[model samples]
Target: MKVAVYPGTFDPLTLGHVDIIRRGAHLVDKLVVGVTTNPSKEPMFSVAERLEMVRREIAEIPGNIDVVEFDSLLMEFAEEQGATAILRGLRAVADFEYEFQMAGMNQQLNDDIETVFLMADVSLQPIASKLVKEIARYGGSIDKFVPSAVAEDVRRHLGAGSR
Candidate 1:
């Protein structure tokens, strides 16, 4: 049973996030979507809200897929969750640079764990959670860049002016 953990803030899962998860799903027996709570980063949605939104978005994903929230090092989280690998989504060169560093660190922390990178779908390459939230905050429609569940959550959050 090969399990892979995909960790991210997932402040609001974007279409790009969905694209990567769907692609990574085919490569692993189980995929755990780990939403992390970053202290420095102000999230647009609460952890519970993000988890619910992810559940709604990935409802069609195979039963092997799981959604959870965490606030710890990626390597530690993966080990605790019994994940044998880490899946990362690379959208551009900038992403590669950052993921590369993190992958190296994770490898150092846990030799049994490996990191796999999946390219984001071309159509969603430019979409990001931060950008989606920014656009929606200014009253711009992100209908195409975000999943329906995420869009609804974004709309609800923005409506109440809660960040």
Candidate 2:
């Protein structure tokens, strides 16, 4: 089985993320979406909440996609899951530098695993979880950036009226 691990904090899954998930699902027998916690950034939602929200958003995708929470090194988690590859999404040139470095480190840690990079769709390229959260912080609409389910959760957390 060709298993691939797509690891991310996924604090609140945006549409760009769903786009990558959908495309990545087609490339592997099983795509494990790792909902992890990033100590560098303060997340608005708990890991449990983020997992639940990701599950809800991906419920309709017809594939062998599983959502799980992990707090270990991504390469270790991928190895534990028996993944043959690590799936990542690239939005632009700026993202490639950081992603490339991580991919190299992951390769060094586990030479058996490969890293696959998927380019975000042109229309969704501008949407990012950080920017989405910033917009939601001050009552800005994120309806276009994230799935409705995620937007609702963000709105509820931000104490904003539902649209």
Candidate 3:
């Protein structure tokens, strides 16, 4: 069976993320969403919270998708999960440079694993987890930026009531 690993911090999975996850699911027999911690940025949500949020968001998606948490290198995680590819989302040119560099390094580490990039939907292209948290932090409406399940969590995390 062909398996793909979509690895990301996913502090709070946004609509753009959902778009990618939905599309990536169809390309592989199984799509494992790997929620990991990024040492470079302090996340607003805990790893467990992120995993739970992603699971809830994808529970109804029509595919063999599962959520997993990891802290080690993505390549190692992919190998451990028997993944044939690593799925990533490309929202804009800004995302390409960093993803490109990481893709090269990941390839060097494991040539057998392929990296697949899926462009975000036009309407959801600007959505990002960091920006979503920022908007929510300042009491901005995140209903359109994230999934309904995630928006509630974001509102609660930011200490805001129902919107």
Candidate 4:
């Protein structure tokens, strides 16, 4: 089976992420979404909370998709999951520079697995989890960047009124 790992912090699952998840599922027999904690950034949701939210967001996707939490090196985690490829979503040239370097490093670590990059849907290209949380914390409507359910979760966490 062709298994791929799409790993992200997913602090708040944005519409862009959902777009990638749906499209990524079609390219592999199983798409494992890894929710990893980034030590550099503080998270609004705990790993458990993120897992539940991710599960709810992907419940209806028509494929074999599952969410798991991993704290080790991504390549090692991908290997553990039996993934033949590591999937990523790109939105801009800036993103490409970073992802490209990371992909190259991962390849050096494990030449057996390939890294695949998917461009985010044009309309959702600007949506990012960091910016979504920043907008919510400052009282801006984030409905455009994330799903209604996710927007609500952000608002609730930030103690803001509904949009």
Tell me each candidate's RMSD, in Å, in order: 1.1, 2.3, 2.3, 2.2
Worst 10 residues of 4 by lDDT: 154-163
- Model 4, position 50, has a per-residue lDDT of 95
Q: For residues 1-163, could you state the per-residue lDDT of candidate 4 as single tens digits?
A: 9999999999999999999999999999999999999999999999998999999999999999989999999999999999999999999999999999999999999999999999999999998899998888888999998888988888888774433
Residue pairs that clash (backbone atoms under 3 angstroms), model 1: none
Model 1 stretches with alpha carbons more than 4 Å out: none
Give the distance in Å from residue 64's predicted Cα in candidate 1 to where it truly belongs: 0.6
Local error of candidate 2 at residue 138 (angstroms): 1.6
Residue clash pairs of candidate 4:
none
TM-score of 2: 0.96
lDDT of 1 by residue, 1-163 (tens): 9999999888888888888888888888899999988888898877898898888888897558899889888888999989999999888999999899988888899999999988888888888888887899889999999887678878988888785
**Model 4, which residues run further than 4 Å from truth?**
160-163
Better model by lDDT: candidate 1 vs candidate 4: 4
**Candidate 1 CA-lDDT value:** 0.87
For all predicted structures, in order, the TM-scores are 0.95, 0.96, 0.96, 0.97
Tens digits of per-residue lDDT, candidate 3, 1-163, equal 9999999999889988888999999999999999999999888888998988999888888999989999999999999999999999999999999999999999999999999999999999998889988888887899999988788888887774432
lDDT of each: 0.87, 0.92, 0.91, 0.94
- Highest lDDT: give the candidate number: 4
